[model samples]
Target: MRASKNRSQKSEVRSQNPKTYEIHISGAEGVYEDAEILKIVKEYTNRALNHPKGKPDNIVITLEQIKQIPQKVPMLPVITLKCNSPDKAKEMIFQILSDIGVPARTIKNSFKILTSPRTMRGAAIILKESGVRVEPDRERGVRVSRLGIEKNTEKILVRKLSKMKVSITTVKEALILASKVAAYTDVIAEICISDDPDYTTGYIASKRLGYIRIPNIKSHGQNYGGRVFIVRENTNINRLIKYLEKTPIIISGDIN
Candidate 1:
């Protein structure tokens, strides 16, 4: 019996393939000092592999020593908007930092504290137009279809926050951070003013830039500062250099 069990175990080891996960790690903004972070990640990865109380069965992990990564191809310049928010400018700072495009895993649990309702009123309106009946369930506080009921509970409403405008002072700080993010990522993102004229000095440097803050319209805010634009006034080499240098930041976290 013992010999038979040993043979079976050996066969299983030979037949099963090792599951390897590839992870890329990068950080900026003065958070970690290399060795400390690498060690922490190494330990964390081990914990992930052996999650749920103890070491997992039939698993092997191999880690590579720290090595230099290759040069990065420059991404397009991101158009950055001056930040303004109602709540002590924290929102402005968050929007600016979001442009850095940190990997999603890092931010996944960050918003868990929020438990707000998600509304589908806009979708309900569209469905109503399409001849589909959308009924509101006051008990559940959500919209539902005539045939199949849809409900929302314990959800966060992100749209409502857009109403709060950031202060002008925060906008300047966010602008600096946005510039850094754009230069680092090499992707030019859109910059939308807060519908406040005070931001003109920050974004109205060129006529190619325009204002349209409608959230319902598909192309409303898309036409703002972005990758492709003609610089009409400056033809000199110095002007071109200056323009190239001031790449705006688009948050890597979102497609927009």
Candidate 2:
């Protein structure tokens, strides 16, 4: 009877371990530096150590930055510290782990942050909480989708751009514009431009499609990204016109 019970326990353990998941981590826009990211990771690790639940076994850390390369590295659950700069932090942590005889590796230019090791209570707790289900599509994918910008239009446009075979230059410009527009409105707007000698014609085409090109607005600043101008909810055109005429117009989308 004792032998049978031990076998059952081993089976349960095998069933609970999931092979992989899509994980990401990022700091508040403009607030994320290597040091800040390290701090967050350290805090998470410490909390896991003291957690009443089990501790995580193997951890993977991925660092992400804009216009910069990303880095991925393995981490030790016990001795690793949190990082501020994702790159430097992960490198330092990896070095420490290596000194202590932990196996680890580092990868560069990763598009996403790391979220792994189940964080405290070990694999058993993670298996319980995550309900350990295996999907064939979960492995070895790009890390670009981890950044959660709330606008739906931006998401759609980004997806659309990813499918096309456009030149990198055009794609870059489109991504910049799409990101700026997505900041203000929930509607996903899309743009497709053909090679045209006359820039005015292209501008006219964009305007005809209800996309008003923002002029003199910095890409990252307020007041000049893609903004939606609408009057109000349940308001008639005449009332909207009157309001626009009388008030300093601040046009957001259909405000509830």
Q: Which stretches of candidate 2 lie over 4 Å from their true place?
A: 1-9, 12-31, 68-256
RMSD of candidate 2 to the truth, in angstroms, is: 25.4
TM-score of 2: 0.21
Residue-by-residue lDDT tens digits, candidate 1, 97-203: 25443223222222211111221111111010122222232112121111100111001112222333433323322333333323422222323222111223223
lDDT of 2 by residue, 1-256 (tens): 0000012233355666534432222111111345577675665455434322233343434454545332211110111123334344335533533443333321111101122221111001001112221211233211112222223433554455466443333333333333332232221222121111111111100111233222211211111111112111233433322322222211112111
TM-score, predicted candidate 1 vs. hidden true structure: 0.17
Worst 10 residues of 2 by lDDT: 119-128
Q: Superposing all C-alpha atoms, what RMSD in Å does each candidate have to the true structure?
A: 21.9, 25.4
Best by lDDT: 2
Model 1 alpha-carbon drift over 4 Å, by segment: 1-163, 166-229, 243-256
Q: Report how far residue 196 has shifted in candidate 2, in Å.
A: 56
